[model samples]
Target: MVFQCQRDSWARQFTTQVVSCCPAELQTEVSGKKATLQGFHVILEDTILFPEGGGQPDDRGFISDIPVLRVTRQGPDALHFVQKPLEPGSEVQLTVDWDRRFDHMQHETQLFIPGQHLITAIADQMFGFKTTSWELGRQRSTIELDTPTMTAEQVVALEQSVNKKIQERIPVVVTEFSAGDPEAETVRSRGLPDDHTGPIRTINIEGIDANMCCGTHVSNLSDLQVIKLLGTEKGKKNKTNLIFLAGNRVLKTLERCHGTEKALTSLLKCGAEEHVEAVKRLQNSMKLLHKNNLSLLRDLAVMTAQSFKSNQPFPPHRKDGDSEFMNIIANEIGTEETLMFLSTGDEKAAGLFLLAGPSAMVETMGPRVAELLEGKGAGKRDRYQGKATRMSKRAEVQALLREFTSHQSTEE
Candidate 1:
């Protein structure tokens, strides 16, 4: 079904009569103005909202105090989706989210003016690149160059030229061209639709370029304010996607970069300009510290092994003088296979490593210790390693090792 079209320009709010209200089809993901169709919708006789079209997003605001989720075109009518549907034939307020609309407008203008002109001046007209397509968004815009890659100098030159044009403050002019007009040959787009008749909208940036477009545009070049080329990347079919930021987005990018600089400066304990050097120094210091720590742990392991060789109690464990306390050490001590556990936070719980010297001892004792400690591990030749939850079973571990050693001595 087609709805009658009404003539309206860019506006923020309006008092419009509701034409119809209906339930959204169940789970039908349809998009009219390129925006997802969602929720219940109401069609208004006249609306201030711009239906998502011409590569710009739909307006967001309230209709009779019910916040519209999204606005999209259904034939010639603008369908406003909302949680609460309005009654047909009722008068309601239609408003646009000014900030969001402005953002989309700026994005659209960027592509129409500086974005298109820059690519034409650089890739094709000058450097011989066949143009493909371009896309614009809230945060960034990407223009595809015909070939997959561009030279570093070309990218730099393109960015510089575009920014220069934006700063020139060239006037933007929008005009209508009648069908079969001589100027129609100048259109960058392939001729208008077959059904297209009457006058076509043409946007002209004074002395820069002109193209047929139906999107909202800025009246002046100064409205764009700033244009920043972020970088270039490979896109579909070896096309070079040049990314950039325009208008308020440039300022937003600066804000985020400043925040990142401040964080880096504070984390590295250095001035903003010296953050890189400070980070390097920190990395070097960490490497040195790691080396020293490993040396200490190795020395401790050897000393701990010596204590086991002698009749000494294990480190970090209670040695009751009244009883014959035993030392159960796991380390490379004169070929005696034992599981060497590295200490973590809790000395009473599982240590870091469950290392042993011999495959037989580790294979037999690994699962036994794991079962007693309610943990698990794997055994290799001459070594077994894993964590144990039965950390408090230090005495049990010591008794098991002692019994194994006694039996070994008898067998020998």
Candidate 2:
């Protein structure tokens, strides 16, 4: 179960014989779409590829030119999933992606070992805060401390303390002990898995801390480059999550933030430092403009309604408005005697309609007009309103309303 990867984390290439290869399927994403990948599960006699475990992702590499999509541990064997299969007992060259492996090592060091230890020590010693739990993410990580909140000043001090340790370049040593060894109790452990049957491994950071871990890690504190505390967020119960980035992640995050600042400067037409104030001013102006526009629209609605004759059937349509505006016009015109059909929207797209008049006439014509406009609506008393998708059929609806009103007057 102890693979070559765990024995020699620096190894990049290895030659091994394939033990078994079987047809398998991997669920993966391609071009932002979920898809099932048809592949083969290959087990090699020995491997340099680290399987996904201990909060670290699997290594990406090639097995004799065949791309390894994923590597996972099944029981005691590391399974390499690939598109093509190799014959059992065939010798193959396993090549690890060094850049990706190093990045993962840096992340694992900060997320699982050194970072957690540093935070726990400083928080408990300096602030009397206890770490409850932690989580590892691909780009960033967080350690939850048993505190309701962490002050900005405390965060700055914590970050400084962590980076100071990194500058010291403390050596990180990995030591293994037999399962029943008494020395194993000295290393901080959260108990082992029930199925575990190997020597216990502990990572020691010079005189700072020692904790049991199975993840790949950097050899020294200096390899982490720097630890950037990205503030904190509320966690479950009375806990606070301190989010952070380490090593190359810190540099990448700075680059992305600088790019965003440059874009904001150009868009706001101001210096980077003044971008926040500039955006606030623009938002205030927008609010005032919106208020004025609504007043003008209501004024227009009243004028249009007042221009209609009282005894005649009124059917008015607008290409640039909504259901609320149509209802405004219907309310101003008084829909008791005169049958009214009001609509507002683009001819090529969806719109809104309002039919208001006598209760009997509105109930009778509401469904017919809604059907013709390819919409659904319900009414109470004399008002019927709903959204319509076929605003282009406005002319047909107008004709239907005119004929109905004319026939009613003749019958009366």
How many clashes in each structure?
A: 9, 0
The C-alpha stretches of model 2 lying farther than 4 A from their native spots are: 30-34, 97-100, 113-116, 307-319, 355-389, 399-412
Clashing pairs in model 1, backbone N/Cα/C closer than 3 A: 123-129, 148-238, 330-339, 330-340, 339-355, 340-355, 342-352, 359-382, 373-390
How accurate locally is residue 231 in candidate 2, as Cα lDDT from 0 to 100? 96
Candidate 2 differs from the real structure by a C-alpha RMSD in angstroms, to one decimal, of 3.2
Q: Which window of 10 residues has the lowest lDDT sum in candidate 2?
A: 110-119
Which tens-of-lDDT digit does each residue in 26-137 have in candidate 1? 2334453444444687888777777765556777889978998777875656788787867888988777787776677666665643235434544455577765667765
Name model 1 segments beyond 4 Å from true. 1-10, 25-38, 112-123, 130-138, 174-186, 190-202, 212-214, 259-271, 298-412
Each model's Cα RMSD: 7.8, 3.2
lDDT of 2: 0.84
Return the number of clashes found in candidate 1.
9
Cα lDDT for residue 42, candidate 2 = 99
Residue 257, candidate 2: C-alpha displacement in angstroms: 1.6
* Local distance difference test values of all predictions, in order: 0.65, 0.84
Residue 157 in model 1: lDDT: 83
Question: Which pairs of residues collide in candidate 2?
Answer: none
